[model samples]
Target chain A: MSDIKILQFAPFESFVSPTFWHKLAELKLDYDRLSDTKRSIFGYYTNRKASGCLLEVDYSAYNSEAQVPKFSHVAHGNIYNKNTIEEFKALDKTALLADEGKQLLDDMRSGRALSDASLLTRFFVLSFADLKCHSYYYWFAFPCPLTPALELLSPATKLKEIPNNGNYVEAISVLPAHAQNFFILHVNEQEKVCEALSLTAALSDFDEERAQHYIYCFADPSEYENPAWLMRNYVALLLQKCPTLIGKSLKFLGLRYDQQMHLDNSLIWEVRQAEACNYEHVQFVGWEANRNGKMGPRMANMRDSMDPAKLAENSV
Target chain B: MHIPNESKFRETGVLTPEEFVAAGDHLVHHCPTWQWAAGDESKTKTYLPKDKQFLITRNVACYRRCKQMEYVGEETLVEEESGDGGWVETHQLNDDGTSQLDDKICELTLDESKDEMFTIENGKRSPLRVVTTDDDNEDDDEAIDMDTFEESGMLELVDPAVATTTRKQDIETNPSNLASVVNASETTNSADSVLRTRTYDLHITYDKYYQTPRLWVVGYDEQRKPLTVEQMYEDVSQDHAKKTVTMESHPHLPGPNMASVHPCRHADIMKKIIQTVEEGGGQLGVHLYLIIFLKFVQTVIPTIEYDFTQNFNMS
Candidate 1:
């Protein structure tokens, strides 16, 4: 490969229809945050192979193909939201997928062709009942938990029902430098504030600066184990990926924070599973969606005569 | 099957103007539709579809607001005090040129013959770029790599496309592989095997309205934790709309041909909204007014049968 100075570098964010989970990462995602055309859900390439910190957007919840999302294929399985794949199937029964699903699976395992969900959906109607699968990972976007924000509030965590912008489920903060600094400062402030108000300090003659540093440094508590402190490091790692955001990611990160967020205090975020990494392969078995080594009762009734085209096991 | 009453408020219960505004503030940050708004307090309103107006009265400001707690993470660079020298922290540089694959995929366009397909010959999985040296010089060397993928169990997308070459004999002299004519539809095999990845999406949206402007309940966290008003604000502003909008979902609001009930038929939408509000330290209220909305809607159209499923699933 010829070497050219990379003028600008950025990490791209892609949200694909669960129907686009072709072999992990082989998706078609648009680079623009908001485009005139519909977001072409690109299959994900495993982070292992693609390398780098990944901002995963998992729509397995929509996999039921019955759970209608307000838009796109995310509404798949929804009693309401209509999807392109569903519309296509409804329009034509003998489409490419209807006849080719079984064969597609056969070649994928053999490493001949990559696997995709749209190609698989043609194996008759899909109901989670027909397949077996499990969650590999998840992201949570939530509100940034802060104590000051709670002052004039209720006691129940579920008191309020919805969150605003800053509130996210799960955000991976990655700015380690800032995180580390904040941690130290926060610890120092805690100690200093305590010492400042302590009546005991009047007699002990505590040195304000030294006392402040003690809680932060290893001056006291020889066996200090702080999980919250450790969690800070993870947040730092997530923040480190801030520059790579695109699409909804900008909404997830690039947005400014008026103040710092504390731990377990925000909305959970969308999660991405390592599909190929976990080696999870899902296929339909007689009107039921099935995964590796597991099966569920087909949602199809006997009178309907449901048969998901099956390829030879271990064919691909 | 529909009514267009933008000014219809307090059609049922007797909520004071303050309570109504406070409730709007809660839903603006807690409701999904309320997340996108423009302008500030005094006139906070969520931009939404004209039909879904029931959100206005959905909020029932509880006497008690939720509590919020959090674990503080790291801040910035640490300052040494023991007369120790200042130390520098290391950071991995952003992704670079070789990392972006625009030219790679674009060049794979079809020519005349279909034989010459697109394929990555080598370096498909580039090494993850990291910078450990505290030195300021070589910091711009980080590239997106596939290092931590194994542990997270999310590594499976980095494969080089390998195209098969086809030999051809043409009218001119020697034959060559082409991109055109290659059966875009025809498969070398009878068909292609498809692999579907299971996706799990947890959407936490805060539709906010800053009525009673001074304070408002945040929202219910998906993890069952409490979110604060500030946190709720942070979550909402993170979106493109960037405004404080009120929710108006009701049992039955006015809209197109006999639309379904707001809280019942659109159960997931409401559940997500309540969960968002609960996560934000906002109080969850019963949609008693939904029944009122239905009664009123029924009075307008006597034949409309209300299908109520008692919307549960809120925190």
Candidate 2:
């Protein structure tokens, strides 16, 4: 059986500071969090509904051919300034799709293809991170790719997400009309697990300077309370809350509670003060970066996890 | 010297271990060394002094001084020779306007925090920068870079946006021109989903010149599962492409809510999902069985439209 226990954020707070990084590798965990929200896991899917060109046909291969714009290849601005990326919004998709959807669009204008932007817009492209975020978002989608199969299923155009697609239909974008929206509950450790082990290395790159400006941009009243401290704390709290972050568990964050309300043991584990200097580098950080996909092997980078039995070892 | 609490004294730019020792020694050599005498209890430091008895505190840096300094609760008057050669006594007041006896140096002044002077650590460097990376640096996980002149060769640029911890400049500076350096930063606006599009298709044209239809596995997900692919064609909603079916008693399938997956066009779709996998990016499968199956289905099915969506509730 895989380790149901996930890594949490609470105990490892000290690792962010240089003083405790050396001790991080020594941490380990055997069980998961107690709540449904906090199980730790690393999941990957073959995204099919993504709307852009696959990397195979990207600019790398087509040097002399027509330079068509792709959604994934389209440039945009960041949240800080719209002054940048101002022009990308108005790109005409007609030119790029001329080769693929040209006949279809012309037919639509000539009563051939439907005028509905949704119909002409078939491919849905998004990155893995975006896909993960979209998992919780709502969208409108049609039932069938075939108008007849769809009409047979529903006379009028019905837009909604449905789940007949098996797990292997991985890595492709579905029609927007068929996109599903639901929240995967994560609490405790699951809420805080890095989508990949690479995230831990990214966490090290986060300094108070960048935290103040970009990543954890302040100014929102809800985030006024020690933005740095709050984010770190919530990350820990949420890690303890979600379970999907852990491998997969029904009870979130592996809660081990006593009858009197005191937790007999914690569900999440964190490696603070990694004894091995490897925790800060890209190799250690990029443990999964270049992999086509997959967390790869845990033993490659996973040094330690917290154990609920060692609650007494806390500094308090 | 007796540092005031009004401002945090940030000793900065601490160098090597040797420098730290030298700095401590310098402070001891320059300042007036006071013995720990049993004077007025509160005003004096009490301790066993050796032959070369130092100051009132073991910490060389944290101490008070004055020329024949008297521990008066009011303030310490430092007597020093002015440039004009007259003896001038200066009183250093505490934050609350109350003056206290601190330290007196032979030739010194306040605001002495030099960049090179302080040895306090900055928040950036870890006080314990243990070897986080192995010295071997035998980067095995990174891809084995393919040589140039390989089929249709061009360097694949890794987008910084994929970086989990992107800096503000990365997200802002040239977001619109992220991958398409050809596109200028000034050529875009909001509501654009192109940059927002996450999929990248590697379309290889199938021509008679090709002895065999070549297929290449590009990327996968975190699980190393193959990414979904399809026979690129018209959208599902077209008239000729539309396959109508009768509004028969329908077997309701799940939605994104239950399985919470890509709703449609997914390889998981009931009719073509198997063909999608069987083909597996190979033209053989798409051409051999999938295309045949699709063509057959289109020819036979007389499609109909019905609304069974409201027939059930979400789980």
Candidate 3:
């Protein structure tokens, strides 16, 4: 089994109840320490709506042209600020998409020619805390190049009706919109583990020396058991406290650690959606075995995942 | 001699061992003997008693008054006066500033003799030589070369008392010379005159991980012998020596062994030099690397003097 694990979550951004802060305090988390303002809330997205994510375009699994920057601050600095997010959102649908966004669409349409920088930037910008906190979910529908041979089933088919498949791996990135820190979580379905790694940098000055640094693994074994289950509960509780995440579109991110590639070129997957159902558990529909959409590999899987043990064993 | 405080030489310029030797030679030539000591064993000698000893003496010729009582024959003069009248005595004082009587002497005719002295007087106000016979002999028709003969009789000498007095006179004139010899030997053994200096051999290598030049102290000296651990304590400054001794490791050798090291500021200086060179697209060679290393090491090991210009077999 791979030593590292990853888990992905669709973030819900809203004003969390004061009781949630009290709960966070009980968990030894200082919620007030997240931001400078007292008005700030726990605005990060937890993976409550998504049943599980699938392994997509693992750079480690392929010999492809890839690069992952040592410092993520460079990408963070290039992204537009809060004011520009609105302007981009207000643009017409036919407007020229960003170079990265266009590259993402092109790669998804043809599961080949993946550009590392475009994928990283697309996912990073779409899940930006500023945009997610404002209930903007259009960017969440990020283009991903996953063409796995999944079984064909009707859209209305119950998630439990699908047969079991072997375990899969996925790359994920989770950001709390109200906080400066972010995480890249790699999910290993077979092991049922999530390797949560933290990436932090100074936001005020992107080029600050020692600005972007990474803590390889932030999750202790004790704290990270059944990572998918923990993520589900955390997200559910977060949404209950901050209801704004409901009906809000959010882009979820995935990451695959690559020794040879830079952070920008490393495998990154993005999925976009607005929570549309009241189901307590998250669900995902894989690309059917019919080779629907000519997807390369399934990047995410939605299934009945309210059960903690089943979620780890199920195809995601 | 005492080693100068290293702080005094902080920021002073540095040179290779060769350059150091050249400069040292210059200083030795210009300064008095007491100011600097040679670092090389071959260049210096231990001041010893035998080397400092020298000869001191005075030569004196004495003449006695003579009066003939009767003439017996054409070639002989019979003297009625006794006590060796009409004779001269010449005495040579010994190395110990003393003289002995009852010694054989050489006699010759005034015209035939090569003796340069006319008269010898032992006194405070006058030198022993009174006149020279060269002028008188130059005009004399009777001047003739004669074989000198040694004799123990029929020779007139100056007052007997003067002979003993002349020995004292020689001693008085030369007391300081003897005193100096004794002084030299005393100073050589005295603690006040101990020679103190510090020296080291430097080796430089490129550190791949740190991406900087690393300098290693391969050896150091205590009075020209490879220094022992105890002597190192005496040479280096107290605080630095303590730190250095603890952190030292053989930079170039493989073993569980350590040697004294100087760790302060070597990297900072090298980094700055590299940055400057990179800006100009300059490359560095072994010689240039050593030059830069020496220039900076002086600031750290200020108390220990070095001659950087000395040739090193880098290969």
Tens digit of per-residue lDDT, candidate 3, span B1-315: 222223211132223333323333343343212012111121122321121111111011112111111111232233223422322112122223333321211112221123232111121212211112122332122112100111112122111111011112224433332112111001111111112222444433333233233444432221122332323333343345445433343333221123444444454565556556656776433235444555665444443334344332222
Models ranked on DockQ: 1, 2, 3
- In terms of DockQ, which candidate is stronger, 1 or 2? 1
User: Residue A223 of model 2: what lDDT?
Assistant: 9
Which residues of candidate 2, in runs, are more than 4 Å off?
A: A1-37, A45-316, B1-234, B240-288, B294-315
What is the Cα-based lDDT of residue A163 in candidate 3? 25
Q: Candidate 1, residues A1-316: lDDT per residue as tens digits?
A: 2431111111221222222221111111222222212222211212111112112223223121222212111111111111232232233212322233335434334423211222211122221111112111111111111111001112212102324211221211332211211111112333333221111222134344443232121001001111111121112222222212111111011111111233322211121111111112322112111111111111111111111221111011
Model 2: DockQ score: 0.01
- The local lDDT score (0 to 100) that residue A267 gets in candidate 3 is 19
DockQ of each: 0.02, 0.01, 0.00
Error of 1 at B297 (Å): 15
Clashes of 3: 56
Residue B55 miss distance in model 2 (angstroms): 81
DockQ of 3: 0.00
